[model samples]
Target: MKRTLALATIVALSLSLGSCRKKNNEPIAPKPNPEKPAPTPGTNPTPGTNPTPTPTPIPAPPTPVNGDNNNTIKPDESPVNATVSIKLTKGARVTIKSDKPLTITGAKLTETQHTYEVTNESGFGIDGDPETLDLSIAQATEFALDKEMPSLKSLKITTEESLKKLSLQGAKNLEQLDIAGAIADEQTLDLSKHSKLRLLALGNRPDMIGKFTTNLGKEYPSINSSNPSTSTSFKEVSLPTSLEVLFLAKAYCALVGADNLPNLRAAYIYTPKAELLGDLSFAGSTNLDRLMLAYTSGGGALNSLTIKNKPHLRDLFLYQMTIKHTSIDGLPTNTLMYKTTNYHLPSIEVHNTPAVKILSLLQIATNLESADLTNNPDLTEEKLVKIAEKLTAVKGVNLKIEADKATDAVKDAFQKIGWTVNK
Candidate 1:
């Protein structure tokens, strides 16, 4: 009985030892790592490096002017739709009140950027008695102020299409006004009321041709007419008395009222397609400084040019044109430069112009041509020779000069260059 019990104990011990060996040889699972993150999908993982995260982008803020919360606009915000947009500058502001909600675009936010409402979808008007209103618009025809705008100082309107009509009444203090784009054939602005206007720039298009009328109903002669003589039928457009600087581009009109503008200092007209009809006279403009009439690409005839009583006239440029009659009486005393290229003047008098330093008379006409410089006491022999050298050496040119001014050298200089010098 004792031997059997000992054998059973030995068998149990062997079975326990076998079970312990089997448990030690089995495979074990590892704990998850905390330092390294898992690799992103479709990415090649390094030996033991963590992947970088992508950052999110922040949005931009709204545009602000001088930290004013009201005059702020986000970049992604939609633009306001407006028929007429006014861009105020130089501390000029106006508050426009309307019956309905109206959108006005192209107003740059400034310190004085006041909020404004359009009167209606079709028009605009001022709310209170604001002085100055500066604005520029495109793709519009007519934009007239509803009320006087009593102290209004300046105004500017630009359009993509031709401006058919414009009206701003009771703007007596308006100093400057600039209008661009094509003006209609019958468009007329009676600026005689704006007596305080100093600068006026009417930038008309090249192809537009219009007439000048004292009365709006009656039509005068066309500026591009074959006969450019002052007729009893021709009417004059009334200008302001305080107009100092005037710029007219592609303006084909019989502009006849320089006697009214006593303070006219400078006038520039560019009429590329029309002839300057009638006596192109500036009879009463005493303060005239510079006058430039450029018919750049046309053969327009200036019938008579009268710059009478102009003491301060310095520069005069008549490019690509024809002058019918010009005498020494028409020349300004203080005229420094007189240039007329591609010209067709039969005779010109530059006898007593002491301040005449630069005289460019290239491409003179071939019909009965003559230039008399005999009475020029200020022009010496040296000055005459220098003037002769500057002239374009066209053959068969006749030049009459003073006997004292025409020396052997001066005669040789003029004669060698195909000019007949008659002393």
Candidate 2:
């Protein structure tokens, strides 16, 4: 019994020791980091959760895709200043918009060649102070001034061909108008309202041989009546009394009588056709200073060139025509004298006047100071001697005769009277 009890005790002790060894081998729970916070539900984690950041986007540049490749700006598209001067070539057009002065000149491809049209599209016209506009074009068939350029003081139109029409209707203050080349046909020009107009120049064209006519309105007078018999009568025609200067070339219309033009200073008429100049009466043009008539051919004997009682008739030039049976009486002694001096007389120039005797013509101009006779094949030495004897009343006279035709006796007769004769 003692040996059995001892063995049981030892078994129990061995089992207890094995249980203690298993309890000591159990694992310990770990502690959390204090530096990091817990993540939210949907958003990303804190910065420490990610290493790299996202980049921002940049925009692209714009492209130029308008107008010509050369990038030249057009004239109309740009702003026009108050005063502008421009020059254009063929096929170019411009619009000048200014309330001030403007001067423009255009040219063609070459100096002699005509090119495409150059136009001005000013709406309000020139409205600047002292308004002045000058336009010179090489060749233009479609050019004009704006209708309401009322303040325009001076206007010059220089072109190869006439504009379709030029109407100075509203240009009241215009003082000078110069048209270089062609003018509009028929009655395209209106000058009745331009009382202040001073200088007017209309150049002649080859095509306008016998087709030109000017109508200065019926308020003044009617030059030509419907009946051909009374066309030369001064009882129907009256002239513009305020007119100062008149010039007509190659125009075949009858002229208004100058008997009423008291202020008339100069008159020039050049007609190539015969019968272009009808009966002319200068009966009362008291202030008349100069008169010139040049004809090509075909006119009846000018029997009505009556320059009676003219006090200021100074210079007279007649070409290619004769004044036969025309009485030029009552020529004033002080006719050609300067306003400050009374010693100087008038100058008479007779060219191609074959039918009219030069000496008989001088009998009317008593105070004649100078005479130029040329191309008179019918002028004989006897007529020249008569002229020399008749001119003896006038002192300090100068005579220029064709040296090839004058005789020594005729030259001596002119030299004996204190006259300077050049043959």
Candidate 3:
């Protein structure tokens, strides 16, 4: 009866304590281990009442993985060499979560006018294996050649994405753009909106390169195409009214119009076996000053045809061939030129022409200062003196005439050129 009474009293006390704790709400404390002396390693400690040591709670810095919560752009210049990481707007899903090891040689926030050109001017070859060119790999070539960096004036692209990248940068200062390889491809970038563009070279992609010169006579100006795959030629080229220079060098099998290039100031032609002298004459090229017709055959030249209105034709060259009469009829004064050796004296009929101020006959003209003219056996001192006096208008004097026999004054001049004068 006494043991039963003890158990009932303990149960009543436990119930009263629980009810008081629930109502008052005392805070719970973490359990702590009981202190004890160090025991030997081999001995097993008693089980039931054993305890774990308490660990120190430390604070940590905010991080992406941990939801500490901070969203702001950060510049990472050290992430890559000479490169900087900028904040990318969340338009597309950018996976820059650290796994893409980008060892950037360069990084910057840039728009269109700023360009990076990779040129091998020092004649260095790229080194590396082509099979390993998995763009994901650090940009390394299979073979490395010397780096020659020549400043590039312009660039061309057939890729729509690349074009878009360049377009996003800006086109205010772009001088020349070429997409000739993509003109026929619809996937090529559309560049017709670049109104300030002075030069455009396009291919036949038709979509990416777009139909720019279809009404070339009316719409897009200054467009050039030489794509053999898509058959792009001069058939669709429209010479802009503001054009100052037009180069048609290797378009022999491709160029279409012969005279439609109006207002061309400078032109380079290499048409072969073609008779274009009649139709090749400039119609609206009244302002034409420089015209190069190298390697273009079929007889008619500056002198053969009537260039009656080209008063400004200052520079003319008929090298590597015999130009028929009338090739130099209407040439401007002081015309710059070069031709085969004149074994016989040339007839410079335009002599005393007002515009004829400086005439160049020697290849190395700027170096020569005076000529030893007194040596020619056929021409005497009187004749040389006259020629010298006339040539006084020219920058340098040339009196180096060849002959076995020479006058005393001529021998003196020859001595000046290191020749031994006859005793």
Candidate 4:
């Protein structure tokens, strides 16, 4: 009865006490380890952990992977900071990300004007995946090609300053590339990797090379004197098999594998100072249509001309050549035009062309050995008379023709030019 009364009294006292705590005697959570710094705001910290005994030192700046001047890029630096990067000598690198109109100043009208411009400009200002790209900055000394531009089919770059190096490894699908004044330091240009490249135009200005003084407060006649030798012209070129049209002005590179290309359609090469050493044999080029060669003011002469198997050749223009051989063999079945001027060959044999409409051999070194036009079915009576009047070198030379297809006037015109008409 006394224990029960005591329990009843304790319950009555606890019920009478307030719910709020008046005072607490429990030891405060042991003061957080004072030596340890507070956890970072977002980081979850272990309650009773120890700090690192020794602090780690910050690493020094990384060294450039290339040479002292940092000319070449590091492998880790493949990610470009911007869409395009341009760096001038001794200047901070600049970046361009805006889709501003980039102009090709001296672009050809016959090639790209119809597709790119209404006036005389070839500009690229598209928002995405532009087909053409022209980055022709005059002051850029180093061009970084870290970003891949896959949709670009045509590219033109012109730099007035010394372009130490250039690699088109970033442009994967280029078709036409024109870099006329971008004088490079490398002696050889290898384009064998560009499998889709079809048209190419490249040249260098000789007078604009080396040091030059500024004029009228502008960077006038910007020069590239990276190589000051007289033989600074390109020594070798590696052309791709897919090349169809080529234009090289002031290019002295040897035509090493140029004739082995089977898809070459047209080639316009002008070299003024170096002799093309190899025989310009186009026997392997079966699809060649037009070939224009002009070599002036050099000892450059054709050692030999071979067109043994070309079937689609149409136009042949040879200027200022000293062809060692007398005959240009294998005039294709579809030849439409053949003209040679300022040549030093003694004779030529043109035969077995049924599609020839124009033939001219002006300013040759000597008269022809014979003029054979026997199988040309396209030489109608009126066309025959016109062709006979233009063959001034046929004077005192025997001319063979299909007499049954020619009119009396066609025969009379050949006889008037001193040609011994042979039926």
Candidate 5:
């Protein structure tokens, strides 16, 4: 029995030894593949350190004069002045203070996109009597009292809401008036009392424009108010006979039958169009000198810019801006000494003007001593020289010509005009 048991145990021991060797001899399993690569130590990008950074958002726009969006006033806010009293028919940001010679500019009272009912709007209700107190619409519905308006020399009612019956009656000493955008609820405000008025700019006041502008001659002797957009005729807008210098821009006045501005010396007109020939006469002008038309783009041609009447016509400045054009015709050939006057014609400036003619008399520009030709590219050098050659009697003329490339054409013109051409 002992021998059999030893033999079995020996067999069992041999099997166990073989199994242990097999397990020990097996190779270790290869490492499994990772999903994502591991980052290098200390190589991560910070928020602002990235090459492409995110942009910051922009802030909102600020509020206006009478007040702003928030009732709260900020440190960088603009202040209000004392000379100009502000009034509003809406909620806004406003700053109020005292000033001298009350001048209000840079504050634009433009039409807003939202059309809130003015009368029903919280800030739009009409306030107390102007006879008793001047008004201000700075903080919502706050009405300041006890302060009387002092004598004002120049008053500008730029905002429509600020125009009140009380204010106009009070400003007796006002000389230069620019109530351009204002509107009075009452259609008529008797301005016949403003007898001392010299310059008035009430063009955009559509309602009261015709009433006052037409009879300006009777009310304010020497007036400069422009004809409104709504005014159909200038029957009432007669320039005062005593007027010396007249400046009218974008106004619709009849120059056709208009004649004999005898006392006028300098006339400046800028409109869409103008025609001065038939009844256009400026004779008997003792001291007339300059005629300038700026931005006269749309207008009828002056077949007769008759200088026979204006021997004193020294400077002619015409800048064509619109599709229409302007001209100086009927210049007398006997216009001698018109260039040497105290305020003589420095040079005739014509830009974008069409149908230019280098007549025998216009050739007197050779004596111009100094000629300026810019933007009048049509006046070629050859043509200019042809005109300059006529002034052989006058002393050497100083000519100025600007063109692209300073071409041979320009050089040839200078040569013909007896100018030592300078490259």
Candidate 6:
């Protein structure tokens, strides 16, 4: 019995050892209640599981500096809309390319720089009161005037071609115009619309041949017709009725009928061409204050000078004119005889007038204050004495006679009457 029991204990011990070895060789599982989740391969930790960090911002660039060290605002070089006013100096050359309106006031413009050159394709508007305006463009084509310039008073155009492109329909306040070098053919410049225009100067061009027209109702104050090289004759030109001053130098025209110009105050006519100047009668210009006629070397002879009933004619200047005869029939006889404070006495000036017998015309000018008859070889001492005696209203006179014609007896007689005689 004891031997059988000991064998059973040995078998039980062997079985226990084999079971322990098999448990150690098999795989094992992880715990189900873990503290944190597993990490992702290419991502951050879970948002709720970890704290986030702050980010840094980028900086801006600095302002550029100029060489002068001044904070001057430069003009926008691009062809964009202008937001500020443009201020230009005298004789400043600048180009503008804007599609907006511009105002040129007196404070913003200079007299020497009145021209506005627009380069953009769009039309612009002009505001404010500018006294003078000269508009030009790169192309010689007609442009549009968007608005009226009422304060513009004077306008000067460099060429006639430019004048044709401009439309003066809006510039109603223009007064003075200087178109000195306009050379156009067969183009009539009509200024009848300008009612307030006072002065018109058209000189210094030879080939400027075109019909000029003005209003018959609105007479101009002054007209300068002094082109020397003009060969084109005008078809028809109407002179102003209230013309106060007139200048005619080397004008190629027929006899100017001064009978219509009643208010003529002063006139200067000088023709050096060999063309004949027909009878220039001033019968209608009775209130003529001063008259100067220079028909020198190559000019035509004075066919006749009619001073018939001129009562207010004070001064007469005849230079280098050959007067054959005197027409003083209807002149007032001793009309200006009495020296009065109301009226000025008449004065005569004759230089190189050899043919006219000056003594014959002295009877008409009895109240003569002065007489200058120099370089006249046709006058004799006897003729001068007769002229001096006819001046019965004047006790003394300022006389300048020819050197060769003044004799000693003539000098003594003139000196006795307090007359200044230059020999």
Ranking by TM-score: 1, 4, 2, 6, 5, 3
Candidate 2: worst-modelled 10 consecutive residues by lDDT: 53-62
User: What does the lDDT read for residue 13 in candidate 1?
Assistant: 47
Model 2 residue runs over 4 Å out of place are 1-100, 103-131, 142-146, 162-164, 204-241, 249-260, 273-277, 282-284, 296-304, 322-327, 334-423
Please give, for residues 181-279, the per-residue lDDT of candidate 3 as tens digits. 122212223333333333344332211111111132122122223323222122233334434344433222222333444545555443332233333
Question: For residue 224, what is the lDDT in candidate 2?
Answer: 25
Q: What are the lDDT figures for the candidates, one per model? A: 0.49, 0.42, 0.30, 0.48, 0.35, 0.40
Q: After superposition, how far is residue 99 of candidate 3 from its true place, in Å?
A: 28
Best of the candidates, lDDT = 1
Residue range 222-285, candidate 1, lDDT tens digits: 2233321111111224578878777665455556466668878777665653353566767778
* TM-score result, candidate 2: 0.42
User: Residue 158 of candidate 6: its Cα lDDT?
Assistant: 34
| Superior by TM-score: candidate 1 or candidate 5 | 1
TM-score of 4: 0.49
Per-residue lDDT tens digits for candidate 6, residues 122-233, read 3223344445544322223232232466655555433323222334556555554434333333334444455544333332221121111121011221223333222222
- TM for every model, in the order presented, reads 0.55, 0.42, 0.29, 0.49, 0.32, 0.36
Write down the worst ten-residue block by lDDT for model 1.
55-64
| Residue 326 lDDT, candidate 1, scale 0-100 | 57
Which model is ahead, 1 or 2, in terms of lDDT?
1
Tens digit per residue, CA lDDT, model 2, 1-423? 888898776545434422432332111111212233333222221121221111111111111122122212232321122122233334553232222433323311222212213333331122233344444543344444434555565555454433334445556665555444433434335554566553343432121011011221121122222222111111111234455555444333444545656656556555443243456656566767666554444544343465655556544545455443343455433222111111122566654443233453554444566777766666678767766776545568777788875788787777777677776
**For every candidate structure, what is the RMSD over all alpha carbons to the true structure, in angstroms?**
31.7, 44.8, 35.3, 31.6, 32.5, 44.4
lDDT of 4 by residue, 174-261 (tens): 6666665545545566778888776666653221111111120121111222322212234566778877666665445665668668
The C-alpha stretches of model 5 lying farther than 4 A from their native spots are 1-236, 254-263, 275-279, 282-285, 296-304, 321-423
By lDDT, highest first, what's the ranking?
A: 1, 4, 2, 6, 5, 3
Q: For all candidates, what are the clash counts?
A: 0, 2, 37, 0, 23, 0
Better of 1 and 3 by TM-score: 1
